[model samples]
Target chain A: MQAIYEYLFGAASFVPHGYCLAWRPDLIAIHALSDGVIAVSYFSIPIALILLLNKREDLAFKRTFGLFALFIFACGVTHLTGMIMLWEPYYGAQGMIKLMTALISVITAISLWPMLPKVLALPGPSQLRAMNERLADEISDKNEAQIQLHNAYSQMEAQVVARTRELQEVNQRLKEDVQRRTLLEEELREKAELLTATNAELERFAYVASHDLQEPLRKIQAFSDLLKREYENDLPEEALQYVLIMQNAAHRMNKQTKDILTLSRLSWDSIKFASVDLAEVVEEVEFDLAERIEESGGKLEIGDLPLVPGDRTQIRLLMQNLLVNAFKYRAADSTPEVKVNATLHERGAPGTGGAYVELTIQDNGIGFNQEDAERIFSIFQRLHGRSEFDGTGIGLAICKKIVENHNGAIEAVSSRGEGAIFKIQLPTSQPTRRNNDAGRNEAI
Target chain B: MQGVTKRFKVLMVDDDPEDGVLVQKAIASAGHKVDFQVVTNGAEVLDYLFTEGRFTDQSRAPRPNLILLDLNMPGVDGFTVLKQIKSNMDLRRIPVVVLTTSEAETDIVKSYDIGANTFITKPTSFADMIEVMKSLKKYWFDSAQLPVA
Candidate 1:
């Protein structure tokens, strides 16, 4: 232990560089400053490497950086020894430090020789910069994608708002339409009720008026007749003439009132529709007008008549009126001839389908002017004065009303000094709804 | 008024006095020995028939062989009177003829439905009325057999 200690501490064994040369302070200071500066630089470099290694934990080739740090520390220690030798002549210490330095340099050199390829393979600063640029571009692309996704979400939200508004508008319009339809239906119902009430009132008025009017007219006729019969011998010639006129007027008025009542009764009266044989109606008319026909010496000719849908009583009345008119208007020279015939008329275009029965009552009598043919159907319308024709002028009007009630039409063709033809068209089937309403209004 | 042989009694029901008078004159002119009694309205006719109210005395209110009913009356119409008379077993035997100014088919139909014996419109002229009365007398008094009073 004494010998080892003597060998390690023996500081006078070697000469110092400063003892062999002139003691130049400036050179020594310069050398010492350089050694100190080199030592400090080496020491600082190793500390920086340690800190860099700690911070860059993910850096590759970590062991290589550790080896480099050790080598730099050894170099810093050798420089520190050189700075000490510059002050004191410690040649043994210097030689020892140099020997350690040489040993560390050899280890470092050998270690570096094997790691040359690894060091070359390691990415350079420029390559790392290029990779970092790519990483930054990827990050930017991801950010752009996130922004676009946000924009799409916002646009979708806006579209949803617009769609919601449109749906709300459609729903509003549907609600309005429903309200309008309900209102219109209610209005139509109210109008229909009002029309029905009016029709009923009018019917009642017609019935009462016609019924009450007959009573007074009957009394007038009765009392006038009583006056004429009770005062026949007491009255003078002129007074008797006046009485005759009064009687004639009263009789005409009574006939007119009766005719008016019959017309008014047609409005409220309900008639049963049945299959009426025209031949039967004609036979009844002939029987009813037998007296008139015999007085006029008229010959009645009957032909084949079809069965038609109509009211039996109305048709009988219709035939009676036409036949009576024929006998009443006979010529003074010729005997009256009345012919009744019926033919089937196809309605609408030829061969189309529906048919109606047409009854033609031709008369060889003193026919009126052709202009008066249509005018004869109007109530109380007469072409001749009461003196010329003895009638209430309501017979043809009644005939017209009866035909209309059966949903039929009556037309006359006549010329002065010539015969007259009364053509009546009757439906083969029951009247259609429109025709039925028209017939009802015509009754009113 | 003591009768030789009780003539055919007729109770004429009418609202108008003039019509009643005319009908009486017509029956008299027709030369029929009809014991015509005039009642002002349907109520009076009912009183005369059932011997009630003013006609409670049996002698004055004789059982009518025939009733001539007017349709349009103030208190009780002819249709109701006809229905009431026909429904009553005692009064239904008396033939009730409808004599009115109404020639409406409804009036005739309703009168017949209520058991009216016959329906006739009162003629406007006196001569026509006389003729109708003659026919009525011939058919009701001369031809028809009445129930025992």
Candidate 2:
């Protein structure tokens, strides 16, 4: 468009000075081409502007189309005035037409600058739609990110509150535990004091009982001996019977006193544990009871024995007592047989260390009923009459006491007329000082 | 009980009078004459031995060659008296024998540790007491040599 403006101005400058320049053939031919172009522009540009105005409701197009219409009208005026200059060639007609042409060209050229920028800068609908979609996606993405950040912040706050609550609960529990422990310690001290007083009382009572009973027993025995020495032949059978009965009663009382003493002594005895060789202990027990075993025709068989921590004297007493019971209660018509076997057992609740040694002493004797199993270990608790079985009923009780003192367990599984099996499980290690290794747990 | 004692004095520390009479009879029946002096508690024994309080005259309270100590007594037990006697250089030479019903290991060990010459668990029957007295007499008076006090 600028190139066309430059071409028109160059042709207008060629007219001779003060002559009828508009009448020149070159100017006339240029004017004719300019007139035709302006007419075509007047029709075509308005039609194009109206089409645009019809498609869009933007009011900016109305002003733009108005200015373009004015450009076409001015060009038409310039072409008509040029024809007037050509017919009136002499006088100031030529200068006046040239100045008017220059002025109209300059105005048209300035107006067209704004139109070209508007036309080139306008975008297609597809491009505009794509840009709108991109802006919408960016806003939604930012909203999603903000929502995620808010959720994460709330989660962190909840975690902090929960952690603080847990800490407070733990602290409260610890305080309660300390209070309970103090109360327990006070209770334990009181119990210890009471036990001391009770022990002293028991000691005094035992002393008085033994002394008073023995003093009367001494007089009776002395008088009886004197009677037997002085009037044995003269005394009647009934009198002698009376003396014997008296003597038996005295002996029984004496035995009862000794048993009571033994029972009391068991509590005061010191516990001494060591690595006891079970195999040797069994052999010695069997050999010691050889005479009774042989008399009962009992076959005593022992399996492999494992070493365990225990008091040797107590263990020996325990084994001796069990063996004696087995031989004494043998089946009437059958030869008694006893089997002693030992095996390593996994540590249970009452047991400690890596493993425990369970020594099972099974006897093929006349076993008591299952109901009598627990009763058999009670002191002086007899299942049969004295004539049926000769026992102080203390042996099994002593064995049970000894096993318990060693921190072990003993149980008897038996059925009437079958056999009794006494199972003893002892840990390989002795019980250690509980608080010495504070952080360590017992090896299970 | 008075007639049973003729020669050697027997000091009996017992709370019950019946028990004291029984011991006097048992000692007498053992075919030995003893001068019986009965005291209810361990304090009386100490008084009689040291000639203090009720027994102020040293000549009437004869020093015994053998002392029969009971393990349990009211107000200062036999063990405490035994400990006092053993710890005293002048009194340690006297033969102190423990005759008590309690055969508890603690009592036995403590009695022995306190320098008791012999420990005898009291029998429940009278006949056994006679035998215990006889043994006590034979072992303490004859077998064991007495140190002149």
- Candidate 1's clash total is 0
The CA lDDT at A227 in model 1 is 78
- For A22-138, candidate 2 gives per-residue lDDT tens digits of 356787667656656665665566567667777877756576566555555555555554544444332243344556656766776776687887867776587778877887788
Cα-based lDDT for every prediction: 0.80, 0.72
Error in Å for residue B86 of model 2: 2.2
RMSD of each: 9.8, 10.0
Among all candidates shown, the one with the greatest lDDT: 1
Cα miss at A5, model 1 (Å)? 46
Residue lDDT tens for model 1, A1-444: 666545554555755555554558887777788889999999999899999999999977677677777778878888888887765666565677778778877877888888889889888899889988988898899889889989988999999899899889988998898889889889988887777666656656655775677678677777778877888888888887887787788778777767766665654566667788888889988887888888777799999988987788778888988888887786677899999999887784112246788889999888889889899999889877777778988889889888777667899999987889999888787632223322342222
In model 2 chain A, where is the ten-residue run with the lowest total lDDT?
A432-441
TM-score against truth, every candidate = 0.64, 0.61
